[model samples]
Target: MNKTTWAMVTFSVGLGLSACGEEAGGPTVEQVAKAYEMYMNVNLATELGQRIEVRGWEDFKPGCKSSGPERVKCITGGKVELMGFQGGEQTVPKPVSVPAEFDLEFEKRENTWVPVRAQKK
Candidate 1:
């Protein structure tokens, strides 16, 4: 193979390896976003008198930065459907498209990162 092609392959492999290694230090952005969305739905349900389930949570690309050895800050801006009751209704829920973003902090507990606090942005 040409040297240029070999160098490109080497760089890609190294980048992938480094990303895998970083997983040992903290939870991923996806985890933080899921937890944050769950909490938001709970509050929304109580206040709106309806149930809410966030769909497509895995697709949320929350901006995560290391706050400490066991802490991470996550900011979110993703589209998800809230599937559940719309109000004080008991029937099946109709899915609603929602564009939401949240700022949250997570602390590592055991083998998972749990949301500790949420801040308004």
Candidate 2:
């Protein structure tokens, strides 16, 4: 084969390998976004003085650097249960530690949403 052809082949192979290695079966950025969304939702509810609870959870991204386990809990006498997904971002970007679980409730006086509690599992 020509030198150019062999070089092209080698480059292509290297690129493919790099892509696979970067992913490394870790949690995706999307997974982290989802967890943030859920956490926000629960926190909104808790601010309104509503009850909250959590049970077991599953990690969306098993090996993701920013992905961790999520727990599902029953709340308000099973009226409102929540599953919280954790983002593994440490003290680099975000000012607060990544939450392991989130409990949200509502406030009757202000009719607003708030976070009742956040815990690190």
Candidate number with greatest lDDT: 1
Q: Can you write out model 2's per-residue Cα lDDT over 76-110, one digit (the tens) per residue?
A: 11112233333422213322323344222211113
Per-residue C-alpha lDDT of model 1 across residues 13-42, encoded as one tens digit per residue: 122212111335444544554565566655
RMSD of 1: 14.9
Stretches of candidate 2 exceeding 4 Å from the true structure: 1-23, 45-121
Model 1, position 96: C-alpha lDDT score: 64
Worst 10 residues of 2 by lDDT: 6-15
**Superposition TM-score, candidate 2 onto the true structure:** 0.23
* Per-model lDDT: 0.53, 0.27
Superposed model 1: Cα runs more than 4 Å off: 1-25, 28-30, 86-94
